[model samples]
Target chain A: MLKYTEDHEWLNLADGVATVGITNHAVEQLGDLVFVDLPEVGAQLAKGDAAATVESVKAASDVYCPLDGEIVEVNEAIVNDPSIVNSDAQAAGWFFKLKLARPADADGLMDEAAYLALVG
Target chain B: MSDTTELGKTPLTALNARIGGKMVDFAGYEMPVQFPEGVMKEHLHTRAKAGLFDVGHMGQVILRAKSGKVEDAALALERLVPVDVLGLKPGRQRYGLFTDQNGGILDDLMFANRGDHLFLVVNAACKAQDIAHLRKHLSGDFEIEELTDRGLIALQGPAAEKALAKLNPDVAAMAFMDVKDVTLAGASCIVSRSGYSGEDGYEISVPAEQAVELTEALLADPDVHPIGLGARDSLRLEAGLCLYGNDIDTTTTPVAAALEWAVQKVRRAGGARAGGFPGADVILPEFERGASRRRVGLAPEGRAPVRGGAVLFADETASEPVGMVTSGGFGPSVDRPVAMGHVATSLSEPGTRLYAEVRGKRLPVTVATLPFITPRYKRA
Candidate 1:
């Protein structure tokens, strides 16, 4: 199932792993992505922690951790070439995979309907 | 995002919105930050073909001498700025600086001698202060008339000449820094063969009512694209041109800003006209002996751009910062991250290594030569 954060991060939960990436709305507003900084694997992150950074030609923005978890893996492709995030923000642009602290906690995140309405 | 209600609208605001400009508040003006083409493409387009910029928000003024002689106006203006204004021949312009009592730059400006009067263009944010500075000093000898009925625009890039020549063929014969009264699209314009972008271009000041017509005529060309502030900043940063308030301010002196070349030999020590402008005591000495710190280009060793306000250190893990980046970003033309900053004079030499602190990590950066791309001005 997919979930969203008010901060514009989207996440997909499968088994005990949650895949995270910035929302398409963020890519639209960021103009052009020139750089991306991803978190290191195995780093313990709390909810609301700044885990990654996305830099456009004009400015930089932080992508926050939606829920407490351990970063199990990160997308090195986004770091190598950030334009992928602007081109495919939801699927191929996923930033990291987190081992959830509590798998059931994923239910607390906003659903597609709620996320869409909030962004609108 | 600021409250757009209070933002000032330029003459080109309506036309800008019609062209997909993402209007934003810049220096309190509702100016475009980018269009649908985006900053990266807009910057590249300006480097390759042509890009039109609405610079109406900048302050424009005309200075005429009370004695009815242009030389008197030029001489009176010399007391405010450290440039050889008297040596500025008619039909030509020169880059200049307004110095303060402490030898710091008040504002950087361009002044052109139009045979009978002087034309000056200054930054929008500092326009009021700059005009006030002029009035307070030269009111006794000159009539300072701020051009409120006009708007300014620039057409820049490699194809800028070809695009602009389509409107006025005489523009093709102009050289860098040349200024002339020309007719474009049936409107009178003060056209100068100069621009902030490192490309060969022209800055034309036109009647406010005719600005839209003039802009539309230029954009009608296949090569000219409407650019916004985002691309303008990147282009100027890549060109090693200083943007007021970001790169040079009251805290930075012209000498330390690596703009000594603009301070002509005629204004220096032992010259015909020496030590006349404000802060000459402090600025004059720097020509012989350099300042404590100097501005230099920075090449970030990583893809992440070392942007303005990033603190600079002499080495990794250094607890104290030796300098700070004044301007930086990805250079679309060079296809690499480029930046400029001020550092301790001893560490200002090209190839000298410095570390910039970004997001709690120290990134390696080298002091590189400025204008990451070689200047492309069509100098005679």
Candidate 2:
């Protein structure tokens, strides 16, 4: 299932790990995705904290963490080719995988239905 | 202040909105930064086919001399710039710089002698200042008029000429740097064979009232699609054209910006004779002995794009910043992250190794040859 924050970041929690990426709405606003600065594996991040930087053709935006966690893995493929975010922002364009520090906090994020309404 | 009231709108604002463009503030104007297809798609399309850009934010001015002799008008213009305007033939254009008393550039502009008048196109942000400066210094005999109600559109690509020829057949016959008065879609216009992107293109000036209609007519063609400022920036960057505020400014000299070529030999020879221009003493010497810092193109080792204000280091461990990035982004044509920066003169040569300090991480980069992609101007 998908969960989202007010900043437009989405997290797909599966088992104990969550896959993080930005929403298609955010990517569409950014125009052209040029570079993705990946967070190092094992780095601890706090809820609502900046985790990575996404540079587009015109500007750069920070990707925030949805919940406190430790980064378990990052998508090196997206870093090498950022157009993945432009083409598939929510799927194969996943930024990184994070092991949640508090599983219960995931419930606080908005569901896909709520996110759609909020973005609209 | 109310955002809508504060932001200046282009003549084609309504049309851009109708086409689903993402409008953003650019140099005080609410212009389209990109369309639904996105900047990368727009940029790549322009490279392969024709892309129409609404560059109506740029200022257009006409200068008429007292005698109406193009040569005298060119001389009067030479006082404010270092270009060899006297030699500018009718129908030809030259890129020039408006300088301050210290030889620093106030703005880089294009001057075209259109038989009966001198046409100038200045940057959007510096237009007012440039006009005021010209009025204050120019002779009373000259008349300077600002064409604020005119809209400028650029159609650029490998097939730009062919596409534009369908609208104005004479456009294909025009040579590079040539300008002429033409009527398209029943509107009187001035079309010039010049553009910022290193592609064969035309810059057409039309009345503001007919801007939307002309744009629609051009877009009606299967080859023409609306482009935005986002793609415009990337295309110019790939072509190695400098952005005024980022790549150059009042603090930057033409010499440091690697624009000395714009200063012709006649200007240098007539430096002392031509007394009114700014910073003649300081600029002329730098022409002979190069500036301390020069603008150079940089190609990063990987996909990590370096942005403006990023520091450059000689070694990887966050050494003292030798220079700073000016304009940088992914060059759509080259499919690599390219950047322009001002580095120490000694390190400005092609193939020089450097490191860009981006967010505390040292990214390896090398000085690369410019016009990162070759320009395709129609010379003949």
Candidate 3:
């Protein structure tokens, strides 16, 4: 199931792991992305922790992790071409994959419907 | 202060909306911060081709001499600023700063001697204060006429001349800082060969009612794109121009802002018009001695952009800040993060190393000579 955080990050959970990326709404607000800095593999992160930084020409913003986990994989493609996140923020722009510290933690996040209501 | 409060809109507001401008509230005005092309592309486009900017939010006024002599108005204006206004020839413009009794800057402006009168353009946010200042000081000798019915637009870049000359052939003959009245598309206008972008450009002041048509005419050129306030800030920063509120303020003097060049010899000590303007006691001495701190260019070592208000430290690990970054950003033309701010004179030398604490990380920076991108001004 796909879930969203109040911070505008999205998480997809499967097989005790979760894939995370910024939502389309967040990417739209950020405008054109010029640089992306992601956390390295094996880096530990707490829920709501800043795991990446996305920079546009005018400003920089931190992207927080939705749930606590150890980073098992990172999207090196988005790091190399930051604009990809602006073009395809949901799927190909997935920032990192985390081995969930607690499989049930995803339930605490907002589902797609609730997340849309909050953003609206 | 309420979100429901109406923000001031320029004459080009509707046109901006039609072009898909990303609007934002700036200094109480609903202005476009950027367009769909974004600040980076808009900035690079201005450096490469021509860009049309709606500068109508700037305050334009005419100071007419009550006694029918231009010197009367010049002398009245000289009392507020340190620049030598009496020496300004007809059709020529000069950059000036309004100084307080303490030698601090009140506002920076461009004043053009229009033969019989003086034309002044000041920052929009400070317009009320500037006009009131002029009235309080010079109302006795000058009639200050606020040109609220006019609009201002700037055509800037390497291709600016080529683009503008197609519509007004007289623009090709105008030299830098030259201001003259011309007719564009049958609309009487005042065109000045000067701008804040540090490029060879022209600022056209037109009738507010005809601003849309004039803007549309310029935008018809293939080289000209509608640039917004976002690229405008970055472009001026790259050129080392000072934004009144960001780079300079009520506490900063022309000497401290590295704007002593704007102060002519006649206004300095031992000159013909010495000590006549406000704060001469403290400002004139800075010419002989020096200011304790000066504004200088800062080039960050890496890609992480350090924005304004970032505290600067003397060493990488030092907690005490020696200065602050007044204006910092990514320079699209330079392809790096460039900044400018005040620093102790001891640390103001080019190539001097310093550290800026950006997002809790200490980033290395070097004090470099200004104009991160060299100005491509056309001089006669």
Best by lDDT: 1
Q: How does each model score on lDDT?
A: 0.92, 0.88, 0.90
Candidate 3 segments exceeding 4 Å error: A40-42, A110-120
B1-380, model 1: which lDDT tens digit per residue? Answer: 34546888889999999989999888878899999999999999999899999999999999999888889989988999989999899999999999999999999999999999999999999999999999999877789999989989999999999988899899999999999999999899999999999999999999999999999999999899999999999999889999999889888888899999988888899989988999999999999999998999999998988889999999997898999999988887887788999999999999999999999999999999988887789898
**What is the DockQ for all candidates, taken in turn?**
0.77, 0.73, 0.59
C-alpha RMSD by candidate, in order: 1.3, 1.8, 1.8
Q: Is the docking of candidate 1 incorrect, acceptable, medium or high quality?
A: medium
TM-score of 1: 0.98
Clashing pairs in 1: none
- Backbone clashes counted, model 3: 0
The reply for model 1, stretches above 4 Å from the true place, is: B1-5
Clashing pairs in 3: none
Instruction: Give residue B37's error in model 1 in angstroms.
Output: 0.6
Docking class of 3: medium
Best model number under TM-score:
1
Arrange candidates, best DockQ first: 1, 2, 3
User: What TM-score would every model get versus the actual structure?
Assistant: 0.98, 0.96, 0.96
Best by DockQ: 1
* Better TM-score candidate (1, 2): 1
Residue-by-residue lDDT tens digits, candidate 2, B273-328: 44357888888888779999999999998887788899899887754789989988
